[model samples]
Target chain A: MKPHWLVRPGSIRLLWIVFLCILALTVLAGLLVHPHAAFGIDGSFGFYTWFGFASCIALIIVAKLLALLLKRKDTYYDGD
Target chain B: MTAISLIPPGLPLVLGALLLPLCTARLRALLVLGLPLLVLALVWQLPAGAVLSIDFLGHELAPLSDSKLARLFATVFAIMAFAGGLFGLNHMRVAELSAAMISAGSAIGIAFAGDLVTLLVFWEALALASTLLVWSTRTPQSRDAGLRYLVLHLFGGVLLLAGIIGQVAATGSVAFTAMALDSPAQWLILAGFLINAGAPPLSAWLPDAYPEASPGGMVALSAFTTKAAVFVLLTGFPGADILIAFGLYMVFYGIVYALLENDMRRILAYSIINQVGFMIVGIGIGTEMALNGAAAHAFTHIIYKALLLMSAGSVLYMTGKRKCTDLGGLFQSMPLTAICGIIGALAISSFPLTSGFISKSMISQSAADQHLTFVWFMLVAASAGVFLHAGIKFPWFVFFQKDSGLRPPDPPLNMRLGMILFAFLCIALGAWPAPLYNLLPYPVDYAPYTYAHVISMLQLLLFSGLAFFIMLPYLKRTLTITLDWDWFYRRLLPRAACPLVRALDAWQRRCSIDTLRHISHFLGALFLYHGPQGVLARTWATGSMVLWVVILLGIYLLAYYF
Candidate 1:
């Protein structure tokens, strides 16, 4: 018996390639559309792309830091 | 008046719940499925005004009314009841089905309540019913969690009651309408509504209690309370500026905490606050479009979030595992569940041609329309964060992470049917949003599928997806929980009480000791004056008594003569 193709490492690599291409196309699409901006600097090219990426990165960083202070065993409240 | 015309919109469902516990399994199933559909039909058929009103407490009380907005919320609530009933039809506990019906009915009642008193009555009913739903799980954690959930909701209810009293006193009106925020009454009302909406500082109650429910119960618990709060806020305090800040805090709080969470259900719970945050912000924005967006998002969010939870619940039902660390690669055996979960994930992420895209974009568009530059950007970023935490993270970790070797099949037919129903709705409402748009309180003026909008939203979301995978190492789940504001009552308050209790014990002991000494001193004085060896207690007592009487008589005679 063989494993499913989608979960295979080779197929996973190919899927990654396809996904990256789609990402590139979306950025290209961003370049193509002239969004009617209502705010300063949001009208710039690939603004949502960069801002979305940057915001998520910042969110993960802050969360990781907060975890250092706040994280506890899943049983934290169980004993109480 | 007909039976329904005399009673409120959701009374039948609540009444039907009473029959559930008494009925046979066949009758119970019938009541579960039939009651909500009956309510749904009745909701749409009602005329748009108060059909039931009476004089109560010297004011007109409209317990049942109909309007486009009310119909919108009631329609979704009824649909949710039907779907939840279908999913939980075989739930081990009959009590849960009963509580679900009551809460679902009260939510519809809230949608139609035209006066503060009527709303308050149904609101408290919702709190108790929801608490029952939590307790129905019959686990120790659920017992304690239900207590916390009940306490917070009761506090919210008290605030709401006090505010209603003050508002009625000050204005002598009970109409449930938009209110100014100038008075303390309005602030109290806003606080109560905010607490239920899962706004920050008090928002910890949501994730802490929600994930403690049964798989079936969680699906039912997810829809009513918070959305009803959004409904009230949408009706009661639109255009309140503070909600914008509250909404934004919930938005990010959900993301960061969910990103740190390991339990799959808890992730969805945190994201509930996040999803509701978007609606709260729209309500805060308070334009016609934004109000519509908030309402539409509530409608769409209920379905999709239910869909997500249904699938998650299905997995839990089959495998008895909920943590991402313990779940993975079940897509191998449960492809239907995986596909449905992914659809829900996409809908929640507002992927183009999904329900979220149509409904949530309107909220962001409204912010842009108002030229709220900072808000607009934050909403855009939060939209992306929605993708990170709920959209990709949930599906990736649960379905595609390293295989946990669980081979549970998709849940039974009823659960699948429930999930499919909502999944179809998520796409149907998005692919053709006209039906949903027509139900909004305001006229639809925005197009969701414009080329630029789709492209930019895709750019934002795809990049967010990229960011997620890039940061996947940090997002990995562990057997740890992140503390939130509930930590105050859950850990700190209990720990802080120990010392306070000891100090009070010491104070009471010292006081008792001092009182004992004082009693001994008083006893010694009594002994000195009147004990056996004392002069007054000896044989001279009679003689002294006679002498004193003689002296008293002589004094009286002398005074009289004078």
Candidate 2:
């Protein structure tokens, strides 16, 4: 069989590092280059970087609250 | 070529659907493949600005007309039918296939219809046919959902009808053209179209009912109804400011609900609302570029959304499981399915070099150029939310999370072929979008791929992925479902109805027993006293009359003598 190099323990750690590096590089690169600003705010360095992160967390918090009000048992309608 | 007058482009598919049950299985398959192709050819050959009118019920009905916009919608719709047909070749119920084809045909019908009368005809037919598709699954859940689907669509159909009647009364024409939303009738028309576009308060119907379809049926269901609404809204009520609010609500509602959702298909269903929300916002912006964005997004959305549904359906078909709670780690066995599903996810998130990247950016660009700062910011936030919820959540939970120890192979050959075809189209369009751009109603001037655009898009999406991993624990799958507007109908309405029905029953009982008894007693007494055999009714009355006459005669004599 071909070596399961992707699943090896060291390889997994290496993969995680690579992923983090890529994320950091994208953020760093975003600071270097200006996006043709859509709004005045979007042109700021790392606007997408921070906004995307914060909005996702904000969305999750809101969804969590909504879950309290709206969430029901999986079989809520069917009554099984 | 001969003038194709009487044969409306959609009729062949509708008629073919009616004939499907009569055909042997092989013949049925061939017809499904053939009908959409024929419609596509006819759609292309028909000249722009050609209108065919038929006299029906003393009103001229333009059942077939052509425009770049109509042709674009019709082309994508026909292509959708073909893909859905190919996917469903080996494993679909006869009834499902027939209903799906009929639904597809009617969508195409609406696309080509030049008059409100013809459009309404096709519109109502679409609701009925699609409801049949829902029920074709024949499951108890599907049956219940199908009934609700039918009711909601019929309600929308009535609104459209009332609006059409009012418009015809007010304007004295049936032409389906753009109108300012100044009158009540026009607002009603917008309301009707909005309801079908999965606007809030009625938006729950889409996620509730669509996931209940059979795997193949869901793929078809994802394509037609909402997109058709977008088409009509684009034509009828472009740049209506209220749509911006409605569209943003849908965009966020989809993300929040999808975030809370566990059923894989339901997640995708909610994302449909989310994606269509973008198109609606584009229409609301109402610039030439934005309208082009709306139309182009609709075209690309059909392909990618169907592809996403196809992947989810394949998982359901292979494993007989739908909830993320019951799914994971199938990438080991189903690499092709996983890859295609991931591609669909990336496209939906508008990652660079995807069809969504090409189509969706124009809407935001238009918003920015117009200096609508708040709209642009919200749209940007919503795009990030999309990547977080759909782009990462979908693939992460289904394929790569902790192994659920179930290893199902990829779907059958035809299903794979269908998914592959759409997957290819997604990338092909993303890499080169000119074909789709040319099909837009307006002229092409916007370039999707630029240094700033690609970099920002990647920054948004990749960071959203980072956020997902950080919040991994919060996004855990659960055995729960999120309630929405449908709860009013499913839970509250029924609960409210029970007390009402009991009160009415008690009131009827009291009226029947006590009130009826009193009326009967009064009538009986009157009958007895006034009978012919009674004393006052006979001799006594005659004696009294004679005595009075005698007294009157005596008085008259006395007066004369005096």
Candidate 3:
């Protein structure tokens, strides 16, 4: 079987490292500057970072559930 | 010059659109590009006041009025026209070009409208022109979609006109001005405006129809109608509290729907609602900064959204496909298109150093400034959701997912140029928003690039991206479409039609034929019993004659006895 560069083991590890670095830096960036919190807790370090992550996960889960209920064949209306 | 001598600023484009079809192809192309520039110049030169009025059927009509808000909307609209004209230069037919121009002109007409009557005229004109643009795609889907689009918009126009008539009748005036939700008429006006702004539960018209246009046609389609509605809302009902609720619903609604969409353009269509949702929220907040944000965001949004759609349009043009399920890894071949699409995606997500960043933050700032904590949090959440749905999902699925093994190159030169121009504007506006800020309806008092603000925005977006990566398996593309409000119209309504019609038909026949049958039965009985029957007519007459003489004598005797 042929191997793709992106899926190579070393490449996969590097990608993970890069992702973690970004996630960590984003969390750390909050320490450098304080947000004028709109809410009481939003002023905390990494507050938005965590909120953004949690909300996205929650939204995707809800969307997946919606997809379960509402999805039909792309040809649903086209009468295929 | 006196008002009598002045011309309405949008007339040249409107008239030129009529003349466009008569010319040769090249000449039509030249006129298409030249007409918008002319309109822009005319819009710029007009002073900020009601400059032209004429007597019309015993009422004064101001066809041209200029204010900071109106001019702001007019400027971006004209720029959009020019960019759209350029993009469609080689691809579109003469009819499409003319329709686009007329729509563009009417949008500007909406901006300059000084009175409700003139505004209604132009509002309906926009509907007519845009519907033509949709139909010019000349596909079956385009035809059906265009019809639906027309029906919905015309219904909205009726609401608007009804409201205008009621308001004018009650006030004994025709002027357009800021209004509150004090009357049913004003609420109707808001509904009319909200429909165009893609506010739900009527927003399905946008995603349902817009994706069916020709690639270049969609470019023009992306700009005018919704933004013009936003323009009117900004003019008419800036501080309506109910809009805040509607706007929040629309924001999340767009994200959820887009997440479930398989078609690339449909995803963007949902995002248009999302973007307009931000503007609507800003208008709802109705602070100075919020109004400015709404106006500024509208300007930047036209550019980036057009850019995004242009990229999607280019993909559809180069390859005869629009569904994300059928596209992937074209970025290897279509580098320019991919990069521009990414820029648009970033801009739309309000990433720092993009137009969306500079413009959209003001709305959230206002929410925070007013200490509407929940609204502020939701706006921030929506911003992150924007990144998840559009910023990464769009480009990632279309350009970088599992390779579909289809390697289509970039679109034609004019399209690339249009995308490049808007992409440049997206970055330029984000980097230096002074020019756009200067053009806003309010004073330029806010800055978008404070350190903490940029950091927080980045944190929200990057973490959202991280979440997207985490959820990659669940987000896989499939050949499925999620049901929306259109289900009522597209599925349920048509299915219900047959029984409804049969019931109505039965009632009609019962009323007419049943009554007729009963009348006929009565007439037949009357004829058989009394009319010209031989036995009764012949013998009875002779017997009665003889009896009558004897009866007369008897009656005389009886009368004497009595």
Candidate 4:
């Protein structure tokens, strides 16, 4: 039997394959569930889905940027 | 006359608090506990519709009643006071304990208030007492937080007073009744109530101030203010449409910020906003089932939130640390607290056998029945988020993360006992919801334990758990403040005001120095010019007068000739 690749440093290339697998799984699940019946493309359903996903990504990006700017040493509150 | 005492039930707690400073620390603590117990006994003995009336400042006030809604809130408040007193016994500062008692009693007064005047009075009293609790910490940060808290609450009080005056002017009645949203007066009252509920734009105040309080102080602070506001909204503005949107926003705001928060106590504080969001949504739906859900949720939430805060308070007490980064593997030493905290976490997440599931499900059911499929879906997603942020993230990060190797002993016996009592209540209520439902303003017809419902909830929450572990890299803790609506005051206003204040100070200093220099120079010149032997000062008063008169006479003669 072949060993699972994630256990070894030599298998770093497997990480991308894992990522793609998850993405494909998500898309397949979406198609199978047929969320279009509940959320049509033309209506607010699409907007909310896109907006929610976009905002989540944007928030993560903004959080990272703010962390760079405003991050403090853990002992900052201790002095006061 | 078979007459019930007309004095307000909450008055003795206030009076006792005033006298508490005179007592020894031991006696003061006893009185703090005893006063609320006595009030609870009084509340129980009073018959339904028992009325109390008094006139103060030309306003008639009545704060006695024993209606189901009043009984429900009052009962829990008394319980909270007792539990809070037990928890606070070791840290017995007379001022804080007394203030907490007064805060609890005032909430009780609002619960039993028969008129708007009485309710408004007690509402303001709640503000004063709770602010005193914050200020009693005697730290600069706590003082600042307390001041900001006072400003927000006082503004809310003014809105309430204005609304009451308008209602009195319009209807010529001071009696408290369910208000329709059509009138401006009623809408004002709703705004006032919503403000205290920690509704949006201003909702940041709860998380901002509460986490800044002393460890014991947060336990007391958790129980009263927001729940009292929920009680008022339930009574006053039952079916407002705007509340639905506000609730949804608060729910998301709580999750987003809680997800970003690093401080353990602050995370719990944000979770309070999230849980209250459910109640507010229930209140907005305003069906029998929804109101019942709200009332029951309030009962359950108070216990679980207090339990959560108590656990966090214990951790703070033991380690003197509050941030998630500073705490981990604490459960190894404090196993009991960890277990109790996890109980609270599960209950809050509405796991099938916990209080939240039985109570919060009704609200969502009502939304679905109302054909609010989108709202229901959003709430379902939020439920998943709740598990991600609070239900699991809290305990996992604080108790089971990469071990920080800091183990403090279990908290004091009284604190443990308090946590146990509340934990027991959480489980008991979840197992047997009938008692809670019977106390609701409406009948409970909806069932919470359905096979499909349980399965879906588990799938959603469990998957969210999977997401949390998977996304742990993104969820790493950092030492930075997440700016909220509070940035309007904490950062923006202060930053904006500093320059203006500096300019004003500079201008004032310059003006003062310039004015002093000019005055001194003028005084010196006057001394030089008018002294003997100086330029205009000689012994010539009489000569000058004669010259002036002669000049005037010559001018008059010339004018007459012309």
Candidate 5:
């Protein structure tokens, strides 16, 4: 059997590079864009930004926790 | 508030659903198909702003009303009901169809409602109707999913009712009117509307429950609940700021989850959230253009989403499989369904020549004019994302993936015909959006097919396509389930209940044992005391009887003296 791709040396290096590039680009774009244009003026605040980010994180965590308990076998609904 | 009721003359359509199950199967099918057309005719003839009010529990209910907005939504709803009934007639259980018709009628009732009370009543009827659709699948998973779906919607309905009561108390007005979200009551009402829009935290419920429903049931389910919420939001809380943030989250949330999903139907369900996200954002912006965009998007989205679901349902019906892993190369045999599905995909992605392109662009244009740069950029990114996951991923995996060796023929002619009609509308609306725009609550000036906009969108989507293909290895299907908020009740609550149940069982066992011991001790004491010739037992029955009679006689003597 072929080895898992992620564990391969070249694949790992490529993954990291891609991750870093995406992160750098996102930050650079945010800095370059006018803050008002990037975020709406009416409701944009440091609080909301943090709140939005935190809410997303919380949702992911909650979903993961729920999956542990509620997930059934793939055939849970299937007829034989 | 004017007392002119907007209730339609076709109120009996609701009652007719109850009579459907009693008819023979063939007649029942005809009734299901024909009733909506009849109602549509009646709705067409009704005078605008016509009122049909009645008293119930001391509150007046205006279950029907006619306004431009109400008429537009109601007309489409009636059309959807007819199409849905036609599509469902072949495969849906008779009882399920009856339930769906009642649900559809209630949604129409909601669209025509002139008062909060009436809207709420119809709102809850929608929930019940939708839940029955989920339950009709007759699987344990569907049963559980249906129960969870009911709970969320009921919670939303309760929130709405509370908000309405608060509004009534504050303003002494039950008329449904657009208001700023200032007071707790108004805010509650907004929350209620947001929940139905599949807003964040609670948003996962839409994706969770919908894909589990019966094939045709899902098509019916997709058109009603969220759109009703959109109707309420557009009417009641147009300028709310919180909605923008919620909408943005939903837009990306849909793309992300859909990207990860393996099931064709679930991917479409997630995409529904994404598409509705655009409308929700429009509602939040509350400009004439934005509101018009929201309204128009609702109309087009309903058609395309239903069409997409129908196409997916056709596949599921023919092959009895839903996962992309199990489906591939179906286009060879199911060419008609595949073509219809691709048209829906293009429309959803807002390709220049599709319904989505015409309707969704107006809101983005509204944002651009407002100088809200971030909102504009995000919307653009979401548009690209829409193409990435749904536009390409859906048709690609289902129709073009390495052949899975299944060549199920196209679904029945009726299903194909329904899809073709919807597909034609999708293209026609894109080509000439005037008719749809004319129907909007506001005038439309935006053109969707500018050279710059079209080219940029194509570039963005094309690059995203490249990315999808490049990273196809990461997009493998897995057997593991992706959890959503329903996990709280489906997993967490049940798991939490298990330990509680065990503890209660142990406590009950100990209590029973203790009670048994105590009773045995009491009996032993009595038997020991009552043993042959022992103490009180040795005293004769005659002596006891004489003592009792003496006591009675003494009481009688005292009474006589008094």
Candidate 6:
């Protein structure tokens, strides 16, 4: 049986392209819609776009660092 | 406050729990579907203000209060029970279903409780019933996890009880009113509520036990306990200030641990703590807006969180697999489940048009309104991170990632129906917030959908999604778990006990054996000297006794002369 079109390699690349377009469109939206921030710096251009991206990157990095000490086999407690 | 006789909304569910096991499957299904709707109707029928008052301990205690906050909480709990009953109608054991009703019923009881003592009693009942729900799974893992859950809750209960005693002694009243953090009793009360809220140093219990429950059992487990804690905190000690710190920690802690989690269910479990943290923070803020946000968030959260769990539960129900490593590409077989799961995910992420969008923003909007710049920043980051972790990661791993060569269809009819009901609710509340807004404890003045608010939220969440794809390599789950606070008790305490137990065993043996030997040796010498056959005991002892008496008489005379 043929694989589902959603999962096939060619469609996968197209999905990525679509996702990127949406990402760009959100940033471009900053021109028409300015996010009113209570804080002074938060209202600057594309603040949420960059902040959201940076926040996730930071979360992943910090989580990875902590994983060094905290990570154990999923069966970590089964021994007890 | 009127004194008209009204049966409490939750009482029938508790009674129904007993009746369920005695009936046929068809009858049981009817009661499960009918009882919670009955409770929901009864809940709304309650008029605002103190409705049922009683004399207790030389004070007027309102055992039933239909305050707006109480009614709001009671309404959600009833919905949770109804949906959960539907979800579990087929898959869950009779014991689990019965226990779930008891748990849900008591949660309703707490919501309507008017005095501190009444709330505490209902809380304890909630704890015991919840423990029974976990134990009903009858797995070794769930049994031990249930024991840990019970111990922690009992510990929390003790703190609450002591707090109530001290409070009563200090104030001479039991009204469950808002308290300032001016007394040790208030602090104890806060600790008790926070512990159940999955606060720090004791937070590990939620993720440790909840995921261990059977699939449907977990859906029921997710709705109460912590949400009830939020209900109490909203009413009992709003604006405590310190909760802000605890809440922030939980939000980040949940995100990071979930990032590292492999088991699909534990990720959801950790996210429960993460989600409740937002409500706690709002309670700390304690503006009318903030409190409304917290209460509203709790209301919406129960629906979406349960929806997420229902979809996840469906996957587990069909596949009999829970680990991320063991699941993937199930969207092929379970399209409806996947779509419903995505809807739940979107709602939980607080995307532009969902129940979460309207409710969660109120908390952040309150923070921003107060110019709590730091809190506002953290909440924004956490909101984005919520999208990163739960909104994307849960569905991404369970349904859409690399194919694992397993094909399982969607769950049974009841489970599908359950998911659809909550899914509809998520969109309905988001699209039309007036019904939920109207039920808020405070008058609703805030509008959630502004062009600016919607735009910022979209950028934040969409970028978070982009980051997820970019960080895919790092976010790939390993076959591992992150260590948490429960390690102190579940692992460390038990491990630490081995040597102490051994030492105590040795000490007990010495007390019974070696110490007894020493006492027996002394007794043996005394017996040897005093025996009837010994020299002093013989007939000659009479002569010796007389000689000693004469000597004593002589010594006494000499002393007198001196």
Q: How well is candidate 5 docked (DockQ)?
A: 0.10
Q: What DockQ does candidate 3 have relative to the true complex?
A: 0.66
User: Measured against the native two-chain assembly using Cα atoms, what DockQ does each of the candidate structures obtain, in the order listed?
Assistant: 0.87, 0.64, 0.66, 0.09, 0.10, 0.84
Where does model 5 exceed 4 Å of error? A1-80, B1-10, B502-562
Estimate TM-scores for all models.
0.93, 0.92, 0.92, 0.84, 0.81, 0.95
List, residue by residue over B327-356, the lDDT tens digit for candidate 4. Answer: 987887898899899999999989888898
User: What lDDT tens digits, residue by residue, belong to model 3 across residues B1-562?
Assistant: 5443356767888899999989998788788888888888877767657557778767788888879988888888888999999998888888889888888999999999988889999999999898998898788888888998999999999999899888987887888899988988888888899889999988999998889888888888889999998999999999888889988989998899899899999999999999999999999999999999999999999999999999999999998899999998888779899999999999999999999999999999999999988899899999999999999999998888787887888988999999999999999999999989999888978988888998888889999998999899989888999988888888888888979889989888877869788787887787676668734444476677889889998999899888
Q: What would the per-residue lDDT of candidate 2 be over residues B159-185, giving only the tens digit for each residue? A: 999998899889988889998998888
As for candidate 3, its clashing pairs are: none
Provide chain B TM-scores across all predictions. Answer: 0.93, 0.92, 0.92, 0.92, 0.89, 0.95
Candidate 6 residue lDDT tens string, B1-562: 2333356777889899988889999999998889999998888766656467778778776667788988899999999999999999998888788889988898998888889888888899899988988887788999999999999999999999999989999999898989998999999999999999999989988988898888899999999999999999999989889988989999999999889999898899989999999999999998999999999999999999999999999999899899999999999999999999999999999997899999999999999999999999999999999999999999999998899988988888999999999999999999999999999999989999988888889999999999999999988878898888888887889789989999999889878769989788887787787778665566775788899999999999999988
TM-score of 2: 0.92
User: Any runs in candidate 1 off by more than 4 Å, and if so which?
Assistant: B1-6, B499-562
lDDT of 5 by residue, B1-562 (tens): 2322233533555777889888998788778778888777767677756777777666666767677677668777877877787787788887789778887888788888888998998889889989999999899878877888899999999999999999988987788888888899998898888888898888878887898888889998999888988898888888687788888989988877777678999999999999999999998888999999999999999989988998999999999999998988788778899899999999998888899989998888788877778888778778767876788889888887667888789988777777887888899988899888888887787877765555444545554554556556766666655656665666678779999999999889868868788788888888787867555577678888899899999999999988
Give the alpha-carbon lDDT of every model: 0.91, 0.89, 0.88, 0.80, 0.79, 0.91
| Model 2 residue pairs with clashes | none
DockQ comparison, 5 vs 6, better candidate:
6
Between candidates 2 and 3, which one is better according to lDDT? 2
Lowest summed lDDT window (length 10), candidate 4 chain B: B451-460
- CA shift at B533, candidate 5, in angstroms? 9.2
Residue-level lDDT of model 1, residues B73-108, one tens digit each, is 999999999999999997648999999999999999
Worst 10 residues of 5 chain B by lDDT: B1-10
**Which prediction has more favorable TM-score, 4 or 5?**
4
Highest DockQ against the true fold, candidate? 1
